[model samples]
Target: MFLTRAPFRALSRQFQQSVRCLCDKKDKDVKTTVWPPENKEKRLEDWKVIDSTELKPPPAENPITRTHRILKDDILRLKKYIPGLDGRTTRQNATMWKHTLFGEGEGFPEEEFFPSHCDIVIIGGGAIGSSIAYYLKERAREGLRVVVLEQDKTYEKASTTLSVGGLRQQFSLEENILMSLYASDFLRNIKHYLGDHVNVNFVPHGYLFLATEEGAEQLTQNSTLQNRLGAKNILLTPKKLKDRFPWLNVNDIALGCFGLEKEGWFDPWSLLMGFKHKAQSLGAEYIDGEAVNFEFEQNEHIQIQGVPSGEYNSTNNLIVKLNTGEVKRITFATCIVAAGAWSGHLAKLLKIGSGPGILSVPLPVEPRKRYVYTIKSQGQNQPLFNSPLTIDPKSTTYFRCDGLGGNFLCGRSPSLEDEPSTENLDVDYSYFDEMIWPHLAHRVPAFENAKVCSAWSGYYEFNTFDENGIVGLHPYYHNIYFATGFSGHGIQQSPAVGRAISEMILHGEFTTLDLSRLGFDRLMVAEPMLEQNIV
Candidate 1:
């Protein structure tokens, strides 16, 4: 059974000093029930449950400023478990977690009868939702509370979890490129403050983009902008790209650029968990409920009540509820709608057309179906695990290794007409045979003869406008904030989006970066940031 090591105690003490991290046990008597089987037989007291806000006493001798690397490494090695882990994804993610500050937990705790409520209510616990919770919790006060309301417990349909999980800076606008650049840095050093428990892997495998004639012109221009902003990894020639990714066929008559070091994918949920665990430890709450509708209390809040009130008068409050015959009232002083595809569906209640209000932009971020197929490699020589995250910008398709034997591959919908209905949540494999396979074959001939592998389908928060996200405040709903319309890039954008949303609510304006450009005012002027790198 896994026992608390010396490093965990040191880490727990560190978190405790930063904020008052409390475990919500009834009687201050913690019980041991659902501890990971790996940690079986150990008593909860022996497990070292330290308050998150508590910190370790400083060492008297050689002073360590922050983020001690070795002790941090040990914290990650201890909390290792994967339920329903697809064989190809388990090891890489866990290993990545060991080095990176990728967050943990499957969105919801598996333990039963959990409570949920907080002063700030965030809808949609995907990347953006959870990220907002992180910032909100990070700046918590004595009694000021924050909570996240998520629909799916397993995140089977979260756009953040389902998307390609890519982050790049090849944007036509300087703001977009710079924001992503800062986000990349934030991702790299997440474990420094969030938790030493996990390293949170953000592999610098690099991003490859191909250019058709028009796309080439766009890439050439954006590459200059990316470079001016210090995105040093931009590639201008096809030869350079071909040399970097030998597997890529760059015969097309245009240009190509790769974010040589600044762009790549990472462990999304671990990032989610890193924020979530720290947030919870610092007194942020998470509720597993589908935020179906809202009550616009004029300038105040949407009410939430029921779901077994907490004895602490402020614990276990579920903000979102299915459309049951009964009505429960839960209120939030400030409410942020980070709901992805479902944001539009929920916003229909107030008829608030997507203008600006954080992640909710005029972006046509509607749900569209996409399929992911898994392909086993030829052998160890062609190991999928070592393969980098590859994208064929020509058709907006990409493939990357899940872990060992197979790769997780997907591409955009053939056309808006071919997209699945918003009501449909089922996986469609036919899209692969009719559209995806042919396009994949053209990009990587190795895949041309590659046999069909098992496939699954999920939704894309299709940004109907330019492929960029819709963030910031709405024109009419000043008090209400929304975080929808990420198109397919929400996961990478979640961390930044979360912090921005929190800053907007508590401080009245974004201090980190001015998100005013992403607001509803843009829609009023009919000016939108059209992203060229949508895949």
Candidate 2:
């Protein structure tokens, strides 16, 4: 019921009252750290006890509203005060909180016309692009200019919006683990970076990766790597896992690596917006359009557009063609292709990286489809599922409770085939019945008869070459850079990648973390930095 289309405005209003009451209390000795309870005589102080009839209006009982009311009452009872607050201040806070949940009801105004020239232009306006923009603004010298080109301003098909929003340091590669650690730290102190006006509701409950006998060795190895890279993860035996989470069926599990802290899910779209808004505040411009073609200046069969100190060359300039039939030629000092799933096509348009032919050295990123499902069990058991986000390595199936007790959200690994187009957002019903449900039911027993509520699909900027992120400048094109090929782990790693790219642009190398391990040169040298934990 919590995830349904039903509006939570009433609950939101009541919660606002509770927050105001907490803030307005004048008692210095009052304990504000705890949430107060309501209806103590009926033992409804926790607010978890509710029947179906309580959710309807009039007789529509507004269960969430009741929950908040009881919570406020408990707080007042604890403080030995009346349960009320200043009405005006309460209304103001309520309005602000409501704005945070549902936006201010404003539309994204179109960028009327394309710019003739700019210092730097970034393709794509998703999380990565926004992060780059924010970081560049934060690091650039005065008079620095930046523009972002986004085909879809609504972000309906953006991978960041479609992501499951999972953040973890259970990666096999050290760089990957480090990036996640950076992300966790950034997320924990997000208010300091993005301002107090924004919050992504990051819940660091943790992640549990289960491995059967066949994959135990690799899982163990990954756990060791993660721990060596300063991650707080521990390898759990079947007995330990069962002792911790009795809801999970660990009968066939050989090993499980559980993150003790600094890992979990959050609202990715909010984070993206925070980046975009902050970047805009710093004078970075975002335009709604698509990049179609690129024109390069050459002399004596030598590509000179991106080369800074080449001998056989001319003045470096490029004409970028947009889908709106307008082409602008400018000598940009640097350009970054931060496009996610469509990075390959953008690279093909430039044809500057390494491969067989000029066209062969594309970014190697493709659009791969992944599905997510939401379901709820009919069982009336109290807190039917209480565990970390669990993953089945053998089946590549992972799931977690969706904050509504019996309701759960689940997904599996990427499909074997690549999607023909990046625009496809349709979910396949058969995949659940045939693939995900069986594995989930087997692992949790309680999910055997779960009712499938809804499903959706999104594209991953899958890397055909190494499946790891590419985070540095191009090998051949000196000034051209890339921050793509994250396969499926871009949202959590965006902050680190953005900071690395910004450092590269400013100082010609990464200063904070050496992300050179994910450089384009690796692909050229036939040495891929293979990562074991992809899910």
Candidate 3:
């Protein structure tokens, strides 16, 4: 019965094809054509109907189309073995299209399935972590898989969002100076890297660091170093400072280091979003979860310099707790601890500080709460629109104009003895009135009558050792790396730090900047990369 039905099925299909052709011909014949009678060949060619069974040579495939076909075939093959692979790929493609057609929306739809494994896993999804993801995926494209685990998607307490968005190249250390210079370049040409729709709202007024008579020599030396390293800045006398900024009171000031170019503040939130959107568009997966713990495997084959012969344990899996309260494990070949202020705590999960030998040295990064207050000084002698972000070395107070209104943002990092509790993000208005107002009013007499309008507090990924970023592999776990301990300059240095981390991961060494001095090895050697300009 099957053999008899085979020929009948073929004949039925042929009959249907013939009927379809006839109906199509009749429909075409009834439609009126605008072509002249002389263009008979063109009309026939335009309305030609080929046979269903006829074989025609395929058209030439462009590079883009060929690449897409290869990717589609690979996805199709993997879909059978990998659950939800096809759906994830489709959603990612849709997200790319959405971002390209209409600028970034709320975000890509929340992913339903968490990835079981990835090539690289970043602990934080703030500016630093997102920037690292962006650089890695951008360089490796589909060849690399990067997953960023962020505890909070809203970024309410993220330091990158709450920062004052200051960018300056005035630093005593060469590494910090170079990083700031590169950040300025990166932000200036941000449209080339992160789509044209992304705007940071950069305000290029520059930074002014005031110094007392006791700190004048150190300030001059810093200014000299900054100028020698391609930073456009000038060492201004108190008379020159008063001339440039009429609102400033330079009575107690001995010297002022003023940035002439490539220094300013931009919208940190926008910059963070740009990095995140660009990273996601480049195939980086951002998981909404916190890294609760780490799982280690005892590997007999692996050996470290200081670790005992048989006691070496390798860590490649992270236990994460999702926002929905589901705990899962994600295995990765490499892990980067860019968790900002929380990096030290995350490191402790892996026995970084508790373990014997080199692991006993803890990651000194921790959250230091600093308050920022916005004040309005409406009366006479208000700071001009172009007033630089001014810092007083004596009191550690800094203030910068906030847009066109008669408003300014001022803050002072509390002394170590007077450090506030990091239990919450509550703003202490009294700290600003007592510690900050006295310094700000003394620096700029216009702020003497300023009334506090609003206040906020954020964590500075403070490094207790030297207050500088630690960017390198861990001493014990070769697979783990760190890009934390940036003190208060992480956001501005994120672009350079991300590229540096990617370089080290992909190329196995520092490529662009020789940040060897700023590595975890420094902690082991008891040598700190101290920067004279901490603010």
**Predicted structure with the largest lDDT when compared to the true one:** 3
Best-fitting candidate, scored by TM-score: 3
Model 3, range 1-535, lDDT digits (tens) per residue? 0010111122333233234333221211111112223322211123222121222224444544544543454445434223355455656655644654345454333434465466799999999999999999889876676889998789988999999999999989999999999999999999998989889999999999988899999989998888898899999998898888888888888999999899989999999988987887666778886786776768788888877677799987677766665556676789999999888888888788889898899999888898999999965776898989988888878988898977889898788898998777889888987888888888778788989999899889999999999998997887999999999999999999999999999999989988889999999888988888877
Off by over 4 Å in 3: 1-96, 99-108
lDDT against true structure, model 3: 0.79
Ranking by lDDT: 3, 2, 1
Can you give the lDDT of residue 336 in candidate 3?
A: 96
Segments in model 2 whose C-alpha atoms lie over 4 Å from true places: 1-113, 299-331, 353-360, 379-386, 414-423
What is the TM-score of each predicted model, taking all chains together? 0.70, 0.75, 0.82
Q: Write candidate 1's Cα lDDT for 218-333 as tens digits.
A: 77888888988889756557776566566666688377776677787777767766666666555555666555344432322322232122211111122244222122334455
State the TM-score for model 2: 0.75
Clashing pairs in 3: none
Better of 2 and 3 by TM-score: 3
Candidate 3 deviation (Cα RMSD): 18.8
Candidate 3 or 1, higher lDDT: 3
